[model samples]
Target: MDTAYCTADGTPYYIANFAQLSESEIASKRRQLICVECRWPAYFKRAATSGQGACFGARPHAPTCSLGAPPSKKGPGSNEVQDILRNPMNHIRIDINYGAHDKVNGDPSDVDKANTRGGRFTGDGPRGPSPMNRRLRPLLKALIESEQFRNSNIIVELPRYTSLPANQLFVNFDAVDEGLANEFRGYWGLIFDTGMSADGSFWLNTGKYDDLSILITPEKYDDFKRKFNFQLDRELEGMHLLVLGKLRKAWSGKLIIDVDDVDRCALCDD
Candidate 1:
């Protein structure tokens, strides 16, 4: 776990030279790292104040990966997360009412009572489908890591829109067009580059066709950066972004999603 690949910059990141990056840069790199050998996902763990060196860890590396980092020990609720992810008939509700400062409410203990239709959790206790309010980050990670999840029939509940199948609710940036305008969805895509408009609005420019972008209004700029621990000066060209917002066509004939709150967005290094 001394080295990993940074998909954002397409380079091998060494742990020893970790000090060279600014705090913001380090935070950004932490989310985008992957195993150098097997290409499995990896994360950065900051050095403890007790003098332990900073290191990298992965959920589970490929079986053939030489690093030998064992798969993370799963708890009683761990398999349940994946179970609901793969089962099409399962329902997962997303509660976006929390603020950026609030903890991600992904705990299975907070299961939604409304999700009792198909009896996905009838017999099993702790191992059953713990249908609860999901956070965007984990759901976005699932979509990126599993093609089956992207096409799954899992029902996701969001504000105003109620519930819809995962495949219908999440749309890629390249697939987005004016046809989806006024429709609310979880718009996900890569960040080709970023820009700050003259009016102080921040734009996460998607390099996809038709000049698609995610706009962070001047009002939400500071919160957005603080929530994501983002630095506009950092090289964010290849980062993946997911925003829960309504698609709209700009006055300039460009497709865009204007994110109203920091809690409505998620960004990853992959």
Candidate 2:
């Protein structure tokens, strides 16, 4: 694929013009890339060492998508819509079993977020064995690939938080605003840019709408990187990130989501 639609600038992007962009420009636009035809998530593939030129690609497009390659002579076409129907997402839930370190009030930095206003909680320590918690990838993938799922009234319930319709619960970064402040929502978007603060906390930011970002504290850095295979040096500008957290405005006026546990977040490629 050579062309894609950028939701950041609301324009079509051609790979041939990719080189015209500076490093910073690419970093900003790459995050908002999507398929021009079906609007599925899209990504930029940099020119490889093997001699391939830079190009655009996306998750499997619907069979009817004009950008998708033709079906092979040996088999029928791929139908994302049909596949979603065969195995629909019943509901969204992420349950993380806490360890001794995660006990409430165990560490000085650990604060009980409940019964308070504008207070943040960092998980005490390492998470215990993951129980049979439903993964968010399938649901996130469905939301990205299926318009029906995105607009559906499916339920998304996070433990300790109020359940809401999928349409209302999952908000893209582009739609974030002050009205949504201090509420727990499934905030998701592309990785426009990333940076490490002097405090050693890392930020995966969407460079629009008050610079919405997901914060990974220093305590959780090791676990977060190990869980997500994250590398700051890598070209991660266009990857997808979904975080289940309370949307809060920082003292600096930046919209932020503090990820207390690694399990509360998920990342994927287009």
Residue 46 CA displacement from its true place in model 1, Å: 21
CA deviation > 4 Å runs, candidate 2: 4-13, 28-53, 57-65, 68-92, 95-133, 207-210
RMSD of 1: 7.9
The sequence of per-residue lDDT tens digits that candidate 1 reaches over residues 1-270 is: 788788888989888776478876764665567889888666565555547666765544566777853336364444544755654337776655433374455333333233323234433445555455566766776765556777878888774565788899999776888899999999986664577889998888763232788888898888788887754433444566889889998799988899976777888753
List the candidates' TM-scores in order: 0.61, 0.66
Q: State candidate 2's TM-score.
A: 0.66
* Per-model lDDT: 0.68, 0.65
Winning model by TM-score: 2
Runs of candidate 1 with Cα error greater than 4 angstroms are 1-89, 97-99, 102-130
